[model samples]
Every structure is written in C-alpha cells, then in structure tokens.
Target: MSTNSRWWFADLVLVVGLASFSGSIALTGLDGPLRVAFVLPLVLFLPGYAFISAIFPEAGNDDTRKFGSDKSEAIYAVGGPERVGLSVTVSVAIVPLVAAIANFTPWGIRVLPIVIGVLGFTVLSALGAFVRRWRVPANQRYSIGLPKLLFNSVGRHSNGSTTMVNIGIVISLLLVTSSVGFAVLSQPTGQQFTEFYVEGQNINSNTNTFYQSNLGDNGITVNVGNREGEQTQYTVIAVLERVENGSVTEQNRFDQQQVTVQSRQTKQVTLNGNPSLSGDNVRVRLLLYKGDPSGSPYRVIRLWLSS
Candidate 1:
C-alpha cells in the first residue's frame, strides 16, 4: 500500500507480535536467554518508539525550524538520531511508569499486569501514530524503508558522514542493549546456603496445626532445600525435649538420617519415632547439619505441644 500506511501498519504488527511472544514466554514459565531476548525490546525500546512515533508522525526535514512570521515555528518530525535516541530514553521511562501505575491497581505491579499495561499502551500509541501519519499529505508524510536504507548505506557509499554517524548510533544502542542483557542473564557467584525447615503434611504446610497426643503419634516432615549451587550432603537429627519452667529438664535423641540433595532441589526426611514424652511443654526439635552432626546444628526448627 502507501508508504505511510506500510510504515505504521508494520510498526503496529511488530509491536503486537513482540508483545504476544514475550507475554507467552513469561506466562508459560519459560525462561533463559530466549525470554530475555524477546522481553528486553518491549521493556527498552518498542513502547517508547511507539510513543515517539505518535507524537511525531511526519518525517524529519533537514531544517528543524520553519521561518514565516517574526516567530520561528518548530517542526513536528524529529531527525533519525533524535527519534531513535528519544525512543530508547522514553522507553526506559515508560516501563517504570507503567509498573508504578500498575502497583496501585488490583494486580499490584505483577508480571501479568505490567505486560498487559505496556502492550495496551504500545498498541494504542501505534494506532494513533498510524492515523496521524495517514492524515498528512502523501508527499509530506514521513516514511522510510528501514531495510533498504540500512542496506544502501552499508552496501554502497551514498551519504558519507551522515551514514557513518547513523551507523555509529545504531552500534552504540546495540552495545547498550547487549550490555544490559548480559548483566541480567549472567549468573554471578553469590552467598551459598541451604534452606532447612520442618512442616506437617506437604512441603510448606503449616507446622502449627500439627499436634500429637504423644511424641510418637505424629511424624515430622523435614525439608532440606539445597542452594549451595551443587549437590550437598546433609544430616538431620530429631531431638525430643521435656521443658518445664522455661527449661529443658530432659532431652533424648530420637532419630537421625542422612540425605543428599541436588542444587535447587528439596529433599524431605520423615522422622516417625520418638520416646514417650512426659512434661508440661514437650518440644520436638529437628536440627540440620551441613555434613556431619558432631558439631552444633546449622539450622533448627521446633514443634511445641502442650500436654
């Protein structure tokens, strides 16, 4: 179709496609470099570019100023460099603004809400830009064949200095985007630790609801989540304590087990045996050790029962 129509239509289609793909990857729980690659553009470029397009639908003229009366009039279209620069800058601002607004809504700045808001804004902006661009005279409407333009610049020497400057800007923007993507995707070495806890039935079930008439009546499900970035060996020990007047009068070691857990995997150990407990406040404590149980416990969780 016409140049202006083609430009806006292509722009809108690209935005919609990218938004749909990125939203799918995020919502489907697909992660990795692919997700980041698709998502970074929406967050860093597309939204802002759409907005800038809406505001300045006419193509940039060589001269920014129009002289007629005593006062000089400003042109609506910005140059290539200005437009691209503004797109990146504005995109950065828009993402956070969308998130901030979503924070107050029922969705509360979650992934789904933020994605919907950004996509909606971008789609609307693209439509506005399309309409505005079409309204301009066919001759004066700003339009460019981006692939042809870039190809011509690189394939042959068309515009010498200007072409080089534009290329430089493109390269700089790519570098900035790549640097950000690398920083986000790179896995840095952080503090390594294991998550140890005691629950009732399931992995995260409330332990407070678990009470036993006798110490041996209930089984304790101990979960050891390995976050050491590698497979780890752990020792879990269950201790039965008889407490009276805020002091433990007697303590007995009931069960001990060794478990091996992979990085980011949780292993559950069930302690089902304990001696007969007799006291006002009886406590069943599960002490976790990294490797050996000879030293003090690394993590401790207790279940208290009133008899």
Candidate 2:
C-alpha cells in the first residue's frame, strides 16, 4: 500500500503539472499553436483520464466492479486503448455538463470559469486516484510501465549521434503536427456581413449627441465596410424623424446614395438634411440595403440629435 509503493507517484505529478501549466496559459491569454496543443489535451483527455483513474485504480480483471461479488478478491482495470477511449468519452460528457452548470452561476460559461472548473475537477480527481491507488497493494495497483520500457529500449541503443537524430525527428514531427492542427482548428468560419455606422461631421465628433441647428450646415457621415467576401453594391437612405411619446410625429427623407465597395474596403456617404425638425430626441435614421432598396433595410443605424 502507501507505506512502501510509489508506482502511481509520477502519474499524479504529471496530471497536476499539466493542469497547472495549461491553466496558466489560458489565464494569461497566451495564443498560438503551443497554447492550443497544450490546452487541447487538458480539455479533451486529462480530465477524463483522471476521472477514470479515480474510479478504477487497480490493474486487474474487469470483474472487480461487478455488483455483489467480494470486492477484495477482484480488480477492475483497463488496457491502454480502452483507457484512452473511456477518457475521451468521459471528457466529452463532463465538459458540457460543467458548462451547463456554469450557465446558471454568476460567472456564466466563460473562459476563466471553465478553465477553473475543469482544472479543479482534474486536480481533485487525480488526487483521489492517487489515494485510491496508494491504498491498494503495489502489485494490484495500476502503473504506467510503457514509458519505462521505451526508455530502456532507447538506453540499450544510446549511441551518441543516433540518439540525437531520433530525438530531433520526434520533436520536428510534434511541432509540425501541432502547427497543422492549430491551423485547422483556428480557421475563420464566421458569417460574412457588412459593417455600417454613423459618424458626426468630423472624426472627433460624437454622433450620439448632435445639435439640430448645426446639422443642416455640417451633415452626418455614414461609413460602410464590406466584409461580405466579395465586392458589393449598397444603398443608403437617410431619414429625419421627430418623435413625441415614442411615436414619430413627423418624418422626412433627407438623402440617398448608392455606392460600390470591394471586399475588405470601406466607403463613406454624407447625409445632409434641411428638414425643420426642432425637438428633444430627434432621430437621424440611416437605412442600409444590399443591391435593392425596395425591400426592408438590411441594416439600420440611428443618431439622436439632442435639442
């Protein structure tokens, strides 16, 4: 038991170390392939492995977990492939469950809380696994002997130059795999759309609060950015409205313009209005349409001209 055996020691240390390192990378907002590679295992494998290890700490037959049989007489353990499959399955279940639970909490399902939740669960499960393994007899407990066997095989052929070349090849393969995986995972797959906004007369002007008297002399500016994955033709219509008690009492069309913008480019349209609108919360509404302005507007932006 724990008095003499430490075979599970290294396994527990690796679990805790990986959890801490990945947690640090996430919390520090580090980005790129290295972070993705490290954190991927944390999310997809480690927690489930720790959970399974905690549940089954012995390296023996599957009869150990059978109901109603004598507990001490049998051991339930899994081989490497079975362990890996179980870990992935359990991790998939755990992550979403944790997220669902986090959805109700004050922190919601955000990065910080998820990292903390997963990290905490992993570390605690690892500790439980260690304790369970420690309580079992050394011969009956699960141990990672594959790495020792590999190390011994390498040591047998440790000629100076060949070993260095093997190590280099392995590192190179890992780096390449990590880079490709990150690229595939990080591709931009979001929806393509145009960005439309209203700005005051100048770059430094605030569009939210405008004086009605100065609007006729210095008109507002509308900017359109094409992120639609292609060149696009856009129609902009500007309207001045006077609203009293949440209802528009007077509405006047001010300006209309049509412009073509290339993908990843922006265009500005000037809207000048001479309508005699005098009141609090006078709105300058800009309607944006793609190609045809006959149907409903594709996007709408409003600016309040304060009295």
The alpha-carbon RMSD values of the candidates against the true structure, listed in the order shown, are: 6.6, 11.8
| Model 1 worst lDDT run, 10 consecutive residues | 148-157
lDDT of candidate 2 over 84-137, digit per residue (tens): 557767876787888888899999987778888888899999999999988887
The number of clashing residue pairs in model 2 is: 0
What TM-score, over all chains together, does every model reach? 0.63, 0.51
lDDT of 1 by residue, 1-307 (tens): 1234454456656866886677666554444587678788888888887888789776543244455552323355565566677888898899899999999998897888888888888888888887887886665555655544332321123477767777887788889899989876675767578898765442223435235653467567778998775678999998888888989898988899999987667889988775667555777778999889977898988777644
Q: Model 1 clash pairs? A: 59-142
What lDDT does candidate 1 reach at residue 62? 24
Inter-residue clash pairs, candidate 2: none
